[model samples]
Target: MIRDLLHNKKRLSLPKGTGILFAMMFLMAPVQIVAQDTPRVTSKIDSTHIRIGEQVQFEISVEADTTTLVVFPEGQTFAPLEMVRASDIDTFRNKDRMNLIRTYALTQFDSGHYTLPRQKIIVNNKELYTDSLQVLVNDIAVDTTTQKMYDIKPLAEVSRNYSDWVRYLIWGIVFLAVAGALIYWFFLRKKPLTQEEKEALLPPFDRALLGLKQLEESRYLIQSQYKEYYSELTNIVRAYLEEEVHISAMESTTEELVAKLEMMQQAGKLNLEKDTITNFKSVLQKADLVKFARSRPDTHGAEEDRKVIENVVVRTKEAIPEPTEEELLQREEYIAEMARKKRKKKRITTIIIAAAVLVVALGGAVTYYGFTKVKDTVFGHPTRELLHGEWVNSEYGYPAIVLETPQVLKRTAIELPESLKQVISTNQTFTYGGLLGDFHISASVTTFREGVEFNMEDAIQGSVKTMEQQGAKNIIVKQDEFTTPSGKKGIKVHGSMDITLPGTEKSEKGEYIILNFNEKGAFQQVIIIHRQDDRYAKDIENRIVNSIDFKNQ
Candidate 1:
């Protein structure tokens, strides 16, 4: 090949060292057969240019299977191009064997030539760059022949206000001076002390302030999270209680602690104050009502509870007076008395159990029980002129207050909240039982159909026969003067009830009585299905119930 080229008289010239170095390079270099590489696109521009304030689309495309999808960095964002949309992607394959392609579209408004820099694509496990692609466009062409642009609005009037910077500087200087004085007073004038002394300097009052400061950070109360707010408030007070009262309130239920404190007060032994404990108990009760029963207090109630907690905290911190010398001796005697009372209770309990055991040993006979015993679940007879509170019940569930014909709510003489009363003044007739008392005072207005009178005797008699006739699984009586569903205490009067009239269809049982007051006396009949407890439930029926005088009023 060299001889054939020399015959043609073609000669190449190189500097003396250059030729030797070139030869060396050619000899030492590795030979590579490079295929024409696919275009490595870094970005895709939808349009090269756009009029100012008018948008253009741009897209960035990469031509490799292995390449990072690029996004404009914080400082490198395109001012000319505003992004209308963005897409996220990772691995992609190309249909063409020569190139793998991916792109991001970008738009620019201001007309100019924008060049996307050399793009990187991974090939043969190495990044190779392709020459940048330049996009070219011209600014919007304006016709001078047409009327000159007429709508060029003038600039906004400049604001020529006086500078307040000097006033701000003076104010800042004053603030800095005051701050410096405060710092000096706080640090240099601060008492040098041991750790204990420093803590002591943070007196109880200052500690309380600190606690209040921390509490201010928690906005639970303002946010109406009363449960959490009360919980934290109570915790703080409970810690204080342990500090002041020498009792671990955290370990005790309110009921248990209150009872213990009450006993101390009644005996006049230890000085257990009331105002503080009462306030404490009130808050706890309100909290318990909210937490356990989901009973939300009204705004006033919540405020009152908060006030009570505050009072408890303040009052509890005051030191109690210790016993004088004479009082100490008196307390010793009082302790002896308490011991004697405990012994007495134990002895009484023992005597009763022993007597009962002895009677059982003698084989003493007892009479049959059910007919005479007061039924836990059922109401027996009806009466007129209830002397006090009465109870009403139904078979379905606990006895709620029964009123007659709840349908005509507007015409009712007695005002009652919906929960405690139901109307049962039925069109159907009721059998009568004799009245146990002289007068029947019914706030229950009879909305009976024309033929029906409020017949006490017939209604009671029919009720008994109905029960015997109907094979009822159970029946409940509505009672007043028992605890209510929401734990409010009040008297509730019933209108009518459902009776399983044996063998007959279920009838509206209405043998209700009116006491001079409500049924707190003998006429407070019960349903066989004893269900509800109304206000003051523990009050038992007795012979004295008959003495409750009846007035026609």
Candidate 2:
């Protein structure tokens, strides 16, 4: 029955498009009652005894739900006691009600006993009263002869210095300019080759001939520079073979090239005479010996080998066929396309690297200022939005319990037995949550006979019974004493319960904390229910409980 009521309430309260979730319920009403027990008001002072002119905090707190408006007794209400300053009204929400507290700093000039008359507060257009409180003001004893006096001292000005950030600003601008220039050069700038630069490009055959002519003009052969001569001689022939025959001749050893040429001849791919092949092998083998073993050759032998290499190159070119017009055109087009792709790939790579570096630098700047906000920006929290959203802090129910929450609790109707209702003068129940949310909270304030004290054991027992009625089973309850910041004591019952909703065999895990505070004839109860596994909801729960204020002096 309770579960069904909660579902109905959530269906009406939640926004459109929200799926049916079985987690929230609220009693909706705006009730105003004017019975003798409607609002419980209390006034207390920080100290009953104080020296003359010494200030004391006088606190008046009223507990009721949002259905009623509570106006505190302000102005010079204390005749003998002078009112110094009235504090801003501090409101607390507890479950379905509000606890409104207003404090006044009072001091008296003359030393004497003072009787604070009962203060009247208007609640929902009805007058409610708090009992008169007492305070004592005594004159402080003064011994003029024993007291020492000190002479006044002159004031001196102190120098102050502030750090300059102009240097950092200038450096930042310089860095940005350099980065921009680099990005432009790598990704955007384009420079075409001049006509002179294009003329510098040489065909493979012409380059090889030019290299041989340069080597012959040098004095390497006459100076017994056999190593240099052999190195240059082999390089020119290897370069010519690679470009014309498409062989990796520059990277191959002499023996490997000879074997490869023999295989190509056997495959009828190339026409090479045995003598020419032998001549090529001899030149390469002699070059390796001179370069690695410091072997020297006579000038006559070097000249003869050079002429033999020249003849070999001429014969090889004669054996090679020239490209047709179509093949030449296709080769030029393929080379141009490849060059374009290389440039495009290089530009894309440069942009990606530059953007990555910029993001890293910006992230560092953000992290240096604030870690939490930056962390949230990168990795968001599940409940951060709700925790930081707008909140309401107000008084609710009789014997008002004050609290603050993300949203206002709605008042719900409660049916009580005739006997229990007679003893319970004012009973207000307010609740929040009945949607697909992680937390649920309820607050209730009940007032009994003015002199009767509420029992802690009975309250805990009543709470356990209520949870059982709501489909809780296998309940494990732990009890502890709690004291609010204002020094009011209460009983806290907390633990886990296995709750199965109506008509469901599967049970969901839930945890709850119930705090019950009673003073005079007023009882304030606050209960929070949350998913056991949600640590974020647990943090919120702790924050709510820690903010409890009883308004005690």
Candidate 3:
């Protein structure tokens, strides 16, 4: 009787709802038939068990017709086990069907037994589900009771490494090379002149005579420009004395020039006649009177004076003794040396100006973006992403230290002293972190009673003491005048300290600041503490300090 009832299922579905259910099942039969007909997917793992946090490989393979499109799972679709890495799909063809294989690196942090749920894979507008898998993540077993423990190794003494010395040596050699090249080019390098050089370096008497001829051609004496005439006359003679006779005649008065000539004559350097010296003195004195005293000379007198000046030049040349071989050689060497020095001086001036421009450009970049950024642009820094991340603008404390920061500052309760309570009628504090944290920020505002005198130095010292109580050791404090954005004068105190976190044995380097502002009876204070070497925190400290503004201002 039971077998007959089971075989009569078609007769049992005569109801209207049951007939609709059969029609719907018939319509979905093709999808089920397609999935059952082909072995499209298979999921497998290398091992069913693994040590916690150890990686395991999970593979999924598919075999399909050549014209099918397949898409694998991506992202955090696997919840119990994290996907460490996912491999690309590998495809191969065998006869009519295409085979594809994909691998995933998976790990689990916790020690537990987990099930990887069936994953959906799409192939040619059809959904195919993979088989469920089981993985057991077990903790590493250790027998501490039977194992012996060893003390930590002490710090080893280390000498300077060869690479460090080599780097320094390379830099030193480069510096010396640049300095030596500059010195040689500027001071010691010798450049000999060609035959044309001798022609260019005319003797003082020849130069002066040529100048006088040019002056005559100018015809200033005929034009009644006595001042111009006298000025040229004096310059020609003075230049001749400076170049040939080794006298600073251009920088001397008329009397001093004459005295120098007499001294040279007495020293046997020259054989100047008494009349020649007298004629030279008279021409110079008359020229000075015309140029400086505005005295005019008649044309005939000027013409006679010009002739006398020419004679004086001729006489002085005759008075100069013949140069010895040694003297001639020395003179040639001196001239060559002077020419070289002039060329080198010009080159050095250009180099200095270029170097200054480069330095100014580099300094401006560093000042705006900081040394870390500048270095990153050259060598690279690790914290560029964090330093330049999005920042938030917010207000904190009662009097309100309004500023922008990378993260919002949290409020903290601070205990007040009895004496402080009497002077500070109302105060509030908002903070974010502690001394040893990567970034710390705090702001405090206090309103004082009438006729209250707030000592800034005392308050700063007290703050340092408070930091010491809070586990800051080896504290070093420094103070400087601070001005707010609104131009109110204030005090800024900054320092470094060694901080030991509450649950850690190691000490960390820290930097901190205390900025105090007093306007009338209202006092605003801000404090910052952070890791010393964290560039992002230091940037935040500077940004906060510079952004402070007072309502009264």
For model 2 the local lDDT of residue 130 reads: 80
lDDT by candidate, in order shown: 0.45, 0.77, 0.79
lDDT of 3: 0.79
The per-residue C-alpha lDDT of model 2 at residue 451 equals 59
Give the TM-score of each candidate.
0.21, 0.48, 0.36
Cα lDDT of model 2 overall?
0.77
Supply the global lDDT for candidate 1.
0.45
Candidate 1 C-alpha error for residue 488, in Å: 99
RMSD of each: 46.6, 28.6, 18.4
Q: What are the per-residue Cα lDDT tens digits for candidate 3 across 1-553?
A: 3344435556885555655556666666775334333647988989889998898888999988877788888886776788899999899898778889999898987787988878888887788888889989999888889998789885455553345346647876785677657656655676676765754577778889988888888879778899999889889888888877888999999999999999999999988898888998999999989988999889888888888888878888888889999999998999899999988986887677557655775799899988877776556443343355555687765545677765566666678879778887887777766665567677777787878877877777888998899889999889999888778788989889999888887888888998988764667788888888776666677777778875421
Worst 10-residue lDDT window, candidate 1: 392-401
Model 1 CA deviation exceeding 4 Å by range: 1-217, 266-275, 298-300, 322-553
lDDT at 97, model 1? 30
> Which candidate gets the maximum TM-score versus the true structure?
2
lDDT of 2 by residue, 75-176 (tens): 888766888999999989877778899998988876778877788899999898888878888989878689876687643444422122345467778877
